[model samples]
Target: MGMPASPAHDTVDPGEGLMKKQIRTTLILTLDDATMSSFVPLLQKGVQVKAQLGRSMKHLLCEQYGVNPEYLTERIQTIFLDGKVVDNVETTTVKGGAIIALSAAMPGLAGATLRTGGLLAAFRDGLTHEEDLEAVDSHELGMVTVKLFNLLVRELGPVLLEKGVWVTREDAESLVKRWADTPLRAIDHVEMDGLKVSLEELAGLDWSGDSEYLLLRAVG
Candidate 1:
């Protein structure tokens, strides 16, 4: 909000007067079993992934994101778009800045009610997502917030972490710091844009934005 109304801010830092402006940091980590287990928490907390908005959840996952239909039908048994429970993924469109939460079948009555097209779905009609006919129907690039729960976190989270997710540098730093206090596994390597970097460097890099989004990727 404080930058010039020009293209410079998008790709330049006049103050530093450098060709390579540090707008965002891309951090990649080589992790082992234990290190990855620790990463599951951040995945559950939610991370942003860039995708085509104004599309159905089914199209977003099955086509755009290339998720297997059978896996989508079986493993990912529950769906939530922007906090409301979803019954028909094919009709409920994901708007810009939408939050999508996925999970394996939850246990008990509440879980049964929340499952997509579950038999008890009618019980929660008040919470079910309904298409917004008023909203525009054009595809555009934007970020979607995704949260994984229970088995989904462990099962699906790694793919997302490896693919990379948008996160605030502060939050990413805090995650690294937390991992420091109670070490689960050794960090195999650290990188920024494919170049090796120290963990400290990754933490202190000038990742800039009002909210300051940085790409965090983990491979195990």
Candidate 2:
């Protein structure tokens, strides 16, 4: 293409454009043999939770709040190694004794999105623009908690099934309950009609029955 109409052209910033367009992010995760094996089931559980929550979150945000759920601007950011964002996606690998940090953007309504409640909360009044975003931040962080919880749950499943890690759902529950306070895994499990579930399950759910569901919740 040739510049024609105007003699002077506007300056462009490629880095700014790239940053705006990028939607997905990743991090290298390393788990020890014990940790890796222990967390698989839990990871699966977290993925399920994410599948569930993604729907409600996206719907409420888009339909009600007028936010584009699929906007690349609302991306989850992840950190690998020692609390650092992974620089490359193609070469990153998850192994034993690994640490991965991840985050996702909430778009223009960051404060409100962060404040919105999880699945159970929807039963009450759903997400409200007036709600405090700090609560949403808490709920989003809960995904990681469920990820860790389900990881241990999955890891223990095999051992309990094959050899035995002496790990049970209760054990995972205890760890999660404790995490409810700290900053790392601090999200309360939602209980509906006596059926209790985690934030991860709520985040990565698929109520639509469609293929290629959103992955942020699952990946979180």
Ten consecutive residues with minimal summed lDDT in candidate 1?
A: 1-10
Instruction: Assess every candidate by TM-score.
Output: 0.81, 0.21
What's the distance in Å from true for residue 218, model 2?
13
The runs of at least 3 residues in candidate 1 whose Cα sits more than 4 Å from the true structure, single-residue gaps closed, are 1-23, 134-137, 181-185, 200-211
User: By TM-score, how accurate is candidate 2?
Assistant: 0.21
TM-score of candidate 1 to 2 decimals? 0.81
Per-residue lDDT of candidate 1, residues 1-220 (tens digit)? 0111111112222222222435356777777666677767778889999888788899888887667888889989999988888888888898888999999999999999999989998899588888898766578889999999998887777777766799877788787766655645477676565455545444444556555788887777
The deviation in Å at residue 159 for candidate 1 is: 1.5
lDDT of 2 by residue, 1-220 (tens): 1111212223333332332232122111111234234345444333311211222333322342243434312342222223333333223333222333323423344423332232222332322222122322122211211222322234222222221122233334333344344344322223211233443432222223223222221110
Distance (Å) between predicted and true CA of 12, model 1? Answer: 22
Residue-level lDDT for 111 in candidate 2: 28
In model 1, the clashing pairs are: none
